[model samples]
Target: MSNAADLRAKSTDQLNEQLLDLKKEQFNLRFQKASGQLENTARVRQVRREIASVKTILGERSRTA
Candidate 1:
């Protein structure tokens, strides 16, 4: 999980990359849950929140620019 300040400091390209990676992870987590192979159930919530945070930060940057 990344802090807001840290995320805000990164370039747009980096944030986009991170967002892509998070989406991929989210998909995998969902797959695991469906297959009953998910160990850390809490990770799904964590990833969702992180995805939201990254998106929020990206929105802020876009509005300011």
Candidate 2:
């Protein structure tokens, strides 16, 4: 997971890519949980937070621009 500072340093395009990947991972994590194969359950929370962080950063940029 990326910290807010790191995410803020990335370009908007890079951030969008990161967000997409995080969403994909989130989906896989949900699938794993449904199948009872999820090992690191905490990862689901981390991914969710990371997605939020990326969205927040992107929103900030968009609003300011």
* Residue-pair clashes per candidate: 0, 0
Look at candidate 2 and give me any clashing residue pairs. none
Which lDDT values do the candidates have, in the order given?
A: 0.96, 0.95
Off by over 4 Å in 1: none
Write one digit per residue (lDDT tens) for candidate 2, span 1-65.
67888888999999999999999999999999999999999999999999999999999999999
Q: Model 2, stretches more than 4 Å misplaced?
A: none
The digit string of per-residue lDDT tens for model 1 on 16-56 reads: 99999999999999999999999999999999999999999
lDDT of 2 at 42: 99
Give the per-residue Cα lDDT of candidate 2 at 61.
94
Question: TM per model?
Answer: 0.97, 0.97
Question: Which residue pairs does candidate 1 place in steric collision?
Answer: none
lDDT score of residue 50 within candidate 1: 96
